[model samples]
Target: MGILLLKLVVGLGNPGKEYERTRHNIGFMVVEELARRQGVVFRKMFWFPARQAKCRIGEHEVRLVLPTTYMNRSGKAVWGAMKKWRAEAADTVVIYDDVDLEFGGIRVRAKGSGGSHNGMKSVLEWLQTKAFPRVRVGIGPKPDGADMIGFVLGGFAEEELLKLEKVVERAADAVETIFSVGTERTMNEFNQLQIG
Candidate 1:
């Protein structure tokens, strides 16, 4: 069989310490975990603010990315990285936090609407395609009377944080599985999992 081309894994999140450990940045957390496993450091790239590491997983070369742009403007980084790598949508996987699913859960999709995620919205807009795969980490629903932005940007509670670690690891595993077995197979295995 021919060698499979390199794949881009983009984790969407805002830049800065303020967003660190927040529900909105679970994407970045997943990518960071993957980076740790590969021993690749994320360095800033011009045009796209991302940490890039070259590593191989199950026979496929992978480029892991964590966008520096804030959640709403994530497309700028994603589009630039995709173009720089000459990667197609099918070869790109975006990891992001999802408010619609319960906390600690994960959902993988081949392609779909962004739902209500501004980060995914920006990526889809910039890429001009929704055909790419994505791993959605559940951050749970917004609390009653809570501002949606505040809710997403807030750090996870102690219990939530512990559960989040497992979710992040699972998300990374899913990414590796996608590269090894293709999205359909990975989705079948991961989408049915409940993280909490």
Candidate 2:
């Protein structure tokens, strides 16, 4: 069969109002943007550790998910969603934050390692595969010798905050591109996006 179209889209982040605007929560921001565009709202699901929303993109029925498992153990919810929807690695796309790229930069990879993301580590662990598509929104540099946790959990700077909505909007556009076209094309078009 050809590449399986998107069935599940998961955004990794800690859950709660306080953590909503942190740099690390960009994944949540992007996916929430998608929900906003589609006019769908996320609701806590009983069968999984996630809040889920359903929407249509083209002819595909897509589910947008935010893990309620916080950041580190995000895999539990992603795996749960996959199982619930019978979606394989190829059919699911995981969106998350990355500290290596400069703030506002975005990267799309067809299949790859988890890198230094704790949330992605947990996802890779539970999914038992590296063959899933992922979108990484930059929140980076960590300011030399800074504590990684504090940096990531910190809120964006005032200037950064000003540009955040556009960044999230662009990333959401990238997700729709992934579904409308495919991962490789999305990567080709989005990987070079020079925001931040």
lDDT of 2 by residue, 1-196 (tens): 3443448999989899999889889999989999999999999999999999999887678999999999999999999999998988998989999999988899999999999899999999999999999999998878989899999999998888888988899999988998889999999999998685
lDDT of 1: 0.88
Model 1, 1-196: lDDT tens per residue? 7685788998989889888888899999999999999988878887677768888777777889888778899898888888898988999999999999988787888999899999999998998999999999999878889999889999997888678778899999999899889889998898889876
- Model-by-model lDDT, in order? 0.88, 0.91
Cα error, candidate 1, residue 160 (Å) = 0.7
Q: Which residue runs does candidate 1 get wrong by more than 4 Å?
A: 1-4
**Model 2 alpha-carbon drift over 4 Å, by segment:** 1-6
User: What CA root-mean-square deviation does each model show from the true structure?
Assistant: 1.4, 2.4
